[model samples]
Target: MTDLDYRLEDFLSQVELEICEYLNKQKTKFPNSSKLLKRFTKRKDDWIHVSNHFRELKAKEKLGCKENSKSKEKTKLQDNIIIRNNELAEVVNELCIAKLFVEDITIDSIEYEPIVFKGDKSIDFHLRFIDGQTAYCDVKTIHPDDTGNWEQYQRALKNKLFPSHASFDLQQDSLGGILWHHSFASRTKMLEHVIEFEEKIVQKAINSSRKIMLFCGDGFRLSKDELEDFADFYYTEKYRKDDFMQLMEAYSMEKEAIILLRNIDYIAYFERKPMNLEYKFIPRVHGSASI
Candidate 1:
């Protein structure tokens, strides 16, 4: 719904700072969903696709007037602003993490949206360590979805395993979908990625020197009951503290793996822990995310 209250906003590059400012400017346009979706998509019908349920609601009315069309279009838009804000929210979330990441190692040399070698995998931000080491970084903002998330699963893994899909050739650069997370989805899905990785690719991320970090936008931040429901669904099999601890331990053994869950006003940093370590900060406006 909003952004983490991040200090040092200037840490963002000029372009990124402009992007954030642009989002701020567009907040004035927020109450309008049709125009918001248009800002994101070039196609006229794409706006409807983003808020298709509204169309169904309008259709169900059995009677529609052109005079009310404009009002009706803007009606459901406000309630669904989160959906409209996904892409932009992700970029802002990444900028927040990038600032922290850059300061962590105190590296000044940086590049944004660079292509990685061994494949065409594009990183959100690339950094050259002070020691002259290089790491490919990708930022993710995962949300709670019940649609089986098969769509992202398919897109993330399709090319890695399917060779005949020529477009995948560009994606073959040691890319993997199995996230080493303070996993939001739980073991079944993570295990599926493990199985798929072993079946299609041989590289073990834990064995590599690269650092992988996952940043869950404010979208992933949930209240107690919502978290419980999410856990019930995510850990559909069992909710064992011991199992989760073991998983976190495994993820931590990696060189520079981090899993952060941040909200508009607080951030919960998880390394190897039964629970996340949380800290409060200023609250920024809320928004959305994809992967």
Candidate 2:
């Protein structure tokens, strides 16, 4: 095998080993009736399958068991599982993105979850380019809500939009809400949310003379079958690239959020696959457009 292939295989092997060790530790923590315990024991060895499996496990855990136990105790345990599982998925995404830059002559190296400043939040990656330039990328998983809660239902009712991706048709209805298309609508909404939420990080990157990047994960909770055809199943196939680019260009000029959008250098998207990163540049302008 090539050096790059070996490196990837080694990295994946190490990750699987770590997961096994963690499960071994959890073996004695819960009772025989614990669903989480059963899940860990039954987890498949496939990398892609395991990723989606954890998410499914999380969803099932949320539905929870009806056993007679203290409410607080069950809530606490469930919360901990959710948080820990999320961390696993986040780390996987970071590592996969890092692999994209491996062997690229332009990038000298990548530091995962680096501490950029003292007493401040850290982005997912810090890339040192060979030409003495640097960039910071923060990876985010973008997925639709599946809680089916009353509040979510209310919001869907008001907005007339929801998320239900089976055949990529917006005609589907679930709980009295029309499914929202990820490529057509969610992409813009996700970008707006990121700008609002990561304002400080973007500002800090700008202040420090560093290029800012947002790596948004578009593939989340996809089934193994869907992942097999991920290239066509992902957001790109649902809409035109030029049309979305035009939409973003227009949205970037809005008066209120122009400052934030102008400073964000790059916004990249991926389908949870190695070497599949796609860049979507957010244009920087001197001034905002008038209302």
Candidate 3:
């Protein structure tokens, strides 16, 4: 599509297509990975509407059954599937947002993940802004697969994928986010992850001379009541408003939060300038929009 005719959905759809093709081609090597893509794409809408697999698993674990059955194994496998799919979803979401950033703040062309940076790491996107500033972008995700017997793959995930993906050495400036997608399995887990990240990661980025973005996960495709309920879960009982405030202090405006709709490959990025609480998702392309 021409630049004038291109939309966000088109970019996202292409990403989705690429992911599906990769999974399909690598099914023999990564059976669970390919199965996850197929399973989610087939019924993504239903999964989003009733996205409580984690809660259900917790409830089952609370039972503390000591039985060794195929059913139990199956349940555990499904849980792993949910985690992996959510993690992979973050990659597609990040790339789409990279395209958006290129269009928004950039003046020249941007390159995708390429191996020509510090530590020989592959920075996600490198672009030049309208004001002649360059940005080295990177997207990071933490998801360790559980069911896999592939020890090598797990090692690579921990060693190569996580540590080597940083965009530390900047040509001029930097732009990136530490994606907290599928890094945790529960609210308590999320709290722990957030604390560790804040203590170690957030401050360093804030102190950096370059711009950094933090994309926290908001994978819920909830109704109005559900969204409000979630807000209460965090702000009221969990005291997450303080965390939000701290995050604002660190990565405030250019301030972005992301959400995927109930169905389809579309993702919405909510942004606010100067980070003054006037946040909205800025009307991105929906599943039914013309591409």
The best candidate by lDDT is: 2
Model 2 spans with C-alpha error above 4 angstroms:
1-68, 114-120, 149-193, 196-198, 201-210, 218-261, 273-291
For residues 157-179, write the lDDT of model 3, one tens digit per residue: 45433223221221212211112
lDDT of 2 by residue, 153-193 (tens): 35444543432322232233453232333342344555554
lDDT of each: 0.36, 0.43, 0.36
Sort by TM-score, top down from the best? 2, 1, 3
Residue lDDT tens for model 1, 141-230: 544332233344455344342223212222222232322122335433333322332322223232232433333433233222223322
Q: What is the lDDT of candidate 3?
A: 0.36
Which has the better lDDT: candidate 2, or candidate 3?
2
What's the TM-score of each model vs. the native? 0.36, 0.47, 0.34
Q: Model 3, residue 6: what's the lDDT? A: 37
Residue pair clashes in candidate 2: 162-180
Q: Pick the candidate with the highest TM-score.
A: 2
Model 2 lDDT-worst window of ten: 282-291
- Which candidate would rank higher by lDDT, 1 or 2? 2
**Pairs of residues at least 3 apart in sequence or in different chains that clash in candidate 3:** none
Clashing residue pair totals per candidate (backbone < 3 A): 8, 1, 0
